[model samples]
Target: MKKIEVFRKDKWNMIHVEIQGKQLVVREISDQWGEDTHIFLSRPALMDWVQERFSAQRFEGSEEERLSIIEKFKEV
Candidate 1:
């Protein structure tokens, strides 16, 4: 399982999330605010979840590529 750390929010309803040490900006479409925590997702997952909550995918990518993309976007 991948570890995800949710960061501060930004304008346009975007939330910064760190997955596997890489940061990704995802928008807050709709959510179920219940009990204690919340759940967020990107475009694809949101679509899938809307259709079926159990819908999920096994992503496949190289670590180098992921890290390279993250490094390219690093502010400093």
Candidate 2:
């Protein structure tokens, strides 16, 4: 698995995004709880989530560039 990004919610909480084969994995890590929660999504599902996330937002760059970045994740 390759880590794509990590977002720190606070001092003790974090969100991790990773790619394992062709699937995407999201993990919620809590230092205080001493446990992690994970969610796995296939390529299609990942694309669906991405579409939903950007539904109301505008891309900073060309749409082709944004799509290329998404394609890079799939290559990983």
Candidate 3:
């Protein structure tokens, strides 16, 4: 993908965002910490809460295990 040129990261790695016109695109980027990061949430607080909970799990055994965990949160 061509770089979006629509977003930026601050000195503290806090992201600042913008999009051309009204278009929105979801993106994932890797930080210096070597983990994937996500963007473009309509409900950021809820999304962050979900991330916090999911990150606590030690049950990531396989694809089925991961899917089962997600299925438990489908309504959230």
Candidate 4:
């Protein structure tokens, strides 16, 4: 069975998540956007989740590639 922990508390919504093994802590947020509910994940968890669920191909290369891409917009 997976363990669940509440990292944050808010009056509007209660946050909870399933965690396994030694993975980094993930945060859950609940909010309303014009009557629609929104749940957000922490940065590290968000990146891993998106890649695992939405990516069709395996990610290649290193962090340098990502840094260089971000550098292109620094002057704008």
Best by lDDT: 2
Off by over 4 Å in 1: 1-59
Local accuracy of candidate 2 as per-residue lDDT tens digits, 1-76: 7786444557676555787776668665677776565455576776665566434366455676567555654553
Candidate 4 structure, TM-score to reference? 0.24
When summed lDDT is taken over every stretch of 10 residues in candidate 3, the lowest stretch is 12-21
**Reference-based lDDT, each prediction:** 0.34, 0.60, 0.39, 0.38
RMSD of 3: 11.6
lDDT of 3 by residue, 1-76 (tens): 2233322354433222233244223332336654334443354553454466446465335656455444433333
What are the candidates' C-alpha RMSDs? 12.3, 6.7, 11.6, 12.8
Worst 10 residues of 1 by lDDT: 5-14
TM-score of each: 0.22, 0.42, 0.24, 0.24
Model 1 vs. true fold: TM: 0.22
| lDDT of candidate 1 at residue 33, scale 0 to 100 | 33
Model 4 residue 62 distance off true place after TM-score fit, in angstroms:
43
Q: Which stretches of candidate 3 lie over 4 Å from their true place?
A: 1-59
Q: What is the lDDT of candidate 1?
A: 0.34
Model 4: per-residue Cα lDDT over 1-76, one tens digit each: 2434432335544333444444433334446522222233444554555346333454343555434423322211
Candidate 2 Cα errors over 4 Å, as ranges: 47-76
TM-score-better candidate, 2 vs 3:
2
